[model samples]
Target: MSDTDKKTVIVFTDGACSGNPGPGGWGALLQWNGQEKEITGGAPDTTNNRMEMRAVIEALNALNQPCHVKIHSDSALIVNAFKQGWVDGWLKRGWKKTNKKPVENRDLWEEMLTAMQPHDVEWIKVKGHSDNERNNRVDRLAVEASRKFQQS
Candidate 1:
């Protein structure tokens, strides 16, 4: 199928972690053709970046068919990775960073890219904690999901 034949999906995503490597959560709101689906999840031990990456991956995975996806995320880590060709460079360089350190969350990055394979994806960076209602709501969803672990 061609890109023009695919459904256009708009998504908002966010992630939160209580501590740098503490409990974390990811949230995504996907909308298409006047319908909306919200997805959220938590991890007992994880990092914010992982959760951020997961949000995009999970949302894309939820789609049953190929789509033209527009993802709005507050995470520059994920957005810039794609927009700046970091992922391509890393793939070419054997998944190692410029400093020769193994890239963190390589597993998730691989899975995310695999899930993204069937879609036309555009990553848009949004300001965190700003005026976007969808972003703010997803942020709350992630925070609340993480807080569930905190209270347990």
Candidate 2:
């Protein structure tokens, strides 16, 4: 591909959990032009949503510039938060729910926004276990990471 035709960046991310509050893992695949990179990590005790947020945060942090980015994920919670503008509303309200309770995962949400500030991002939701090869790969990597954490 010519320089002008090269894709700036594309990322696929997923998170896996052995249990809601058990071992968790996050996986991310970053692609730019003809290059591919993968990142994965796990926590001994955590929630799936935290892992999901971490995947995006780490993926964005991997980039050195404010390049255009496309992010693919299977987590409805993450996808809808951005798509429906819920995240903006949450931040505007100081990360509080309508009922006055603190929003869950606020720290990660804020971190993700900060990491994303330099990029023009487009979030796309992909069906899990479908034909998207990259997404599936990240999903499996997340599960593997989770298993490794559990074993440790």
Candidate 3:
């Protein structure tokens, strides 16, 4: 199908960190029709929020071209940032928050914004560690990736 005619892709993403700032990882699952793709990566030392943002940035980057995409994430930090206009406000204020503090995860947020610019994206928030199958799956993937970075 042509890009314009393609079905809206559904994405589920999650991030995990063994010690909040140690051995962090991100996981994403993308589905369009019957086709699915799983993407994951980790950093030996990172914050959970950064990993969360990376999950989304990587998912959007994996798309071949601009298309309608719906992203479901278990992070309010990720969801509210967009749904509540924090990102736009940050951009307008030179990446500072209303209190004039630099936004945390500014780099990942910038990367995510750029990655998402080419697509029509809808962000959906889902409760973490709940009954949501896809969310749970990605969470497991993220945890697994995080464990890989743990000291052996």
TM-score of each: 0.97, 0.91, 0.95
User: Can you list the residue pairs that collide in candidate 3?
Assistant: none
Predicted candidate 2 versus true structure: per-residue lDDT over 40-117, tens digit per residue? 998999999999999999999999767778999999999999999988888889998667788998889989999988
Q: Tens-digit lDDT track for model 1 on 48-127?
A: 99989899999999999999999999999999999999999899989998888889999999999999999999999999
User: In angstroms, how far off is 58's CA in candidate 3?
Assistant: 0.6
Give the least accurate 10-residue stretch of model 2, judged by summed lDDT. Answer: 1-10
lDDT of 3 by residue, 1-152 (tens): 46577559999999999997899899999999899999999999998998889999999999997788999999998899889998889989999999999998877887898998888889999999999999999999899999889999
Descending-lDDT candidate ranking = 1, 3, 2
User: Candidate 2's error at 132, in angstroms?
Assistant: 1.6
State, as a TM-score between 0 and 1, how close model 2 is to the true structure: 0.91
lDDT of 2: 0.90
Question: Which is the leading candidate under TM-score?
Answer: 1
Q: In model 3, state the lDDT of residue 87.
A: 87
Write the number of the candidate with greater lDDT, choosing between 2 and 3.
3
Q: Name the candidate, 1 or 2, with the larger TM-score value.
A: 1
